[model samples]
Target: MASQAPSRVGKTLIALIKIGLYLFVLALVALVVAVSVAVSQLPSYQELVRRDDLGQMIRVRAADGSVIHSMGPSFGEWLSHDEIPAIMRDAMIAVEDRRFHYHPGVDPIGIARGIWVGWTRDDRVRGVSTIAQQLARNIFLTNDRSMGRKIREGILALALERRFSKEQVLELYLNRVYFGGGAYGIDAASRRFFGHSATELNAGQAAIIAGLVKAPSNYSPTADAEAARARANIVLQLMVREGAISEAQARAANPQQVEFVRTAERHNSARYFTDWVLPQLETLIDETVQPIDVWTTLDVGLQRAADEALNANAPSAQAQGALVSLDRDGAVRALVGGRDYVDSIYNRATQATRQPGSAFKLFVYLAALETGYTPTSTVVDEPVTINGWSPRNDNGRYQGPVSLRAALALSINTVAVRIAQDVGTRTVADMAQRFGITTRVDTNPSMALGTSEVRLIDLTRAYASVAQRGVAVVPYGIRRVTTADGTLLYQHRSDESRVLVAPWVAAQMTDLLQAAVMTGTGRAAQLGRPTAGKTGTTSSNKDGWFVGFSSGLTTGVWYGRDDNRALPGLAGGRAPARAFHQYMARAVANRPVENFEIEVALPDWQVEPDAESWYGAPDDYQLVDPDGNPIQPVEDGPPPPPQPREPGSATTEELNQEWLDHAIGRNRAPQAVPQERRGPPPDRGPPPRRQQQEVMPPLPGQRQSAPPVVRPTETPPPTIRPRAPGTAE
Candidate 1:
């Protein structure tokens, strides 16, 4: 019975052994099939060899090709195997894969370790990606974590090892990996961190650059100096252990002391310009396999100056600001979108659409100049109501006859509306659009006061046309675009037909604008040289602008609250003009002083008081004196008011003082009210005994009806003082 039991046990053991053998055979067959499938699906060798996705980077450079910034993936230039520094190669191999040279793109020991860890752990904590395997994954595969992906990566790695030399494989790995700061390869990483090519890298820099292969942003010196140095130390220690460098050499490396260059993009001032230029690139090149160099018209010096000026002055206005500077040919020199690039990147200079305020009056006045109206042509600066939109003068006062130059300098909204009504709003809008203002302007009377919304760049370009003697300007940032191999894709060519035949108008307008800067609202923009500009203050002080030009360049500055809230008391004469002055003073410091060309003046160019009558002012619109008497249209200033009083009372000054107590709060003087008029007793008399009354002087152009004086007893039905032109009030 014992012998029979032993036999039975032996049979059972033999059966179990046979089952295990069959299972092992089945598993081996599945593994072989998987490997075969992965190999068959390996990416084509041509795809690997023709890798040029790294060349799709767009590099934006100044006109002289000095790099301003770069965009897209793998912006660094590619390099060959021999060009890589020995120290750099050693550092990478020591830390990333010490058996790089010995392995056939897959290390058996590393694979075993990874498999054991992955099976026992909740998450795969080990990676056996060799340099060749990494290159395969980077170039041809996604970063998906799965058994299928791993098998494919391994197969591709093996194929790469068989197809290329170890040097070529390592070179591909080094040049294809991502480094921090938008750098892709060793060449770019070197230049990015050290401001020099990979060939110029030292042992310390090479170690730091190599350490980033593990995790670029995590150990980037620009992002985290401590983590980057600690990682570099690990690379150095590995190098020492691998015998690639002596212990003393590793200890003396001092990776922490590496002078990391500031590779952060410096497109602060040019952000708006670059953003505008990027879209324009599509017009020049549809597709390319290499980095395209875009030569832009940006002057870094001028850009720096503009940024500094805007930064220093913008905060004072409690608003964002945009400034665009263009050369005489409409080449954009500098553009600042807001106060700071870090706070916001909305590109206010190019993308923002805001009311230009009275700056648009330049177009209206320019249109008038085109139509035989000289700088001295008279226009009535009087109260005007158009379709329930009453525009008043800034001070709620009117001048019977103001020269076109003086009206513009004062930004008189009524005079601008009257002129637009006379010359036709469409004519002014057409002139504005013809000069480069692409914004749609309505033919409403308010459009004459800059109710139309336009971008700062487009408006500045329009002013550039005026500065350039009526030559139309297409404001452009890109000077030329070329491939890395210098194949020309686009180049700027000037066109002469853009010049207006009425060139004399620009010359005359320039004189008028110069008067504005020299003795008017833009006095803050004066540079002691011949300059011309206009100041614009919108309703509620929401937008303030100064668009001005020197013979060398024209600049437009806009200051406004981003939320459209009013910046009370802020005007173009204040912050905007100051910023313009500061920027222009520095921009043209080195250029030879120049002046606007003078066109021969006509006999009627001198201001005439009655000239405004030719514009068909309403017959009911009568000029009135401060005393509420009808005024004659005299060529000179209005005559002194008639003072009537009892004989031997007092001087005019004493009578004014005595009348202050009895003056009417509104309506008119008690005496000026006709005896036949019907109304309550005018409060022109002093308040009873202890009560003192105060009153404001009557507006010169306010028409009198009946006396309605305000007193302590009543509000006098609320006197309605007309709103100042362009004021929300």
Candidate 2:
């Protein structure tokens, strides 16, 4: 019986031992899997922790070409502990970990004590960390304090202490920490927090800073004060327990003396400007290296002027709006993305896809002129509907049988819509597309009333083509980018190649736009200098836009909310226009006060007949004297015809009257004519036409319908232009 009992006990022991072995193997496998997943899930070190480099955009003065925004080496003027005061170091120790000097990085004894208190005594002191441990976490680990990461962090912390001395580690940690409000490093923190050198610190201020180290957000001066005070008191007690301070001394410390960075001025109205400028760098680099300097073209003085003007002008009796200022080549000089970017980062200028209102009439008029329709071509500005879309003028009343110039100047939506139908929205959109307008425009007849959504960037860029008289320079923010070591990374140069449209067509559009600003809704955007621009008010007063160009500067403004909520009393002619004028007036003050360079791009006509005369180009044209002397064509073919007129219509009377001044006899003015619409691509299913006649525009970048009127080749072209600066081009 005794022998049997001994064997039974041994069997039981063997079974329990096998079970323990199985559990250990399962735990090890689980740990390996978790480690693999964590490492894989982490972002690249360059993007998260080990990243030291951020490109600093360098802003240069347009006149002097001096770099401004930020100097190279964004870690500018950082100091070591020798340069930092001993009091500052002591303060950090006081707030963070009093035993920092006495212990290695791991502090296992403290951790053991923490476990006892947390598990047995039910106290929350489970985080038995030293300053080095905190630094290790900050520089390497994430804020997540999971058990697995904590184990890894301990291993890493021990390795770090072995590699670096206490002082070296402290210096790195101090120099790399962030203290709210976009500030990094102790030097910036001190300057921002105390408004003084790190060498100058009182006990109370030191205590306040020390308190912030525990839980930065919790003890942040920006958050709650009572919580910060309570945390600071806890840190004070720790200092006393560590013998670094007497109880009396700890009691003497109060947070009241911790004066915050005395100025809230750093985050001033420039947030919107910076937000707009930052995104222009996506294609500027291949891989992240040292900090790259991006020299911007913003004039800070002009930026401030623009911001001040917008706020004062927007509330005009009862309106809210936004503003943007740009250089002549379309480099945004200054922008109020919204009243405040934090209020909303959706930049109204670049992101808002709002209806352009009657401001779209500029494109209609330009299309007419490009197709040989003159400013004197008359149209009735009556209430009109196409399909089911009805459009009206700015005021409900329409002026009948008016010249193109009069209809555009008065911003008659019905007249513009009629003209768009005649010339085709495709034609106007094509002209606009050639001028750098990337928005997908609508082909509906209401498109003439600006039913299509347009971004301020595209609108301003398009307008710049008119100012350039033919060539449009695409708007760019960063002009040049260079590495921290002064190696050139990328540089942007303005391309002046003409994409489409003749210089004459640009001139005509400019002339019409000039008329709009000089005696229309855009009058508010008029700078005292020679300028041309247009004003746009969207539905329900949701967006107010003003875009214009001086002889040397072009700018645009739009005001709206991120929620797509209507802004009360907002209109293109009110605050947005006023801000436009304010920014341009100051922006161009330093520019040369000369008119924009303008010239007609005429195609050299030819009259040469091909072999067999199967197709001799009939485009041969010649210059003739008013007395009827013929000038030979550049290429020989056919004789110039007598002035041609549109078929019977009231527009003929206005056309002949305007052309009479330029022609000797039998003169005819250009008239707007309708273009055919191209249907959908072959093999694609067409939905019910009754459900949809034409597709509305998608988002900003998608393609819809191509503009009908293609660009003209070089030839004997007539030039049109906005006469002066105040002209509503």
Off by over 4 Å in 1: 1-51, 75-77, 120-125, 265-267, 315-317, 387-389, 600-729
Most accurate candidate by lDDT: 1
The backbone clash count of each candidate, in order, is 2, 34
State the lDDT of candidate 1 residue by residue for 557-620, as single tens digits: 9999889988877888888999999999999999999968846333222122123323333566
Over the stretch 101-128, how does candidate 2's per-residue lDDT look in tens digits?
Answer: 7776777678888888898877665668
For all predictions, the C-alpha RMSD in Å is 17.6, 14.5
**Candidate 2, 683: how far from true, in Å?**
50
- RMSD from true fold, candidate 1: 17.6
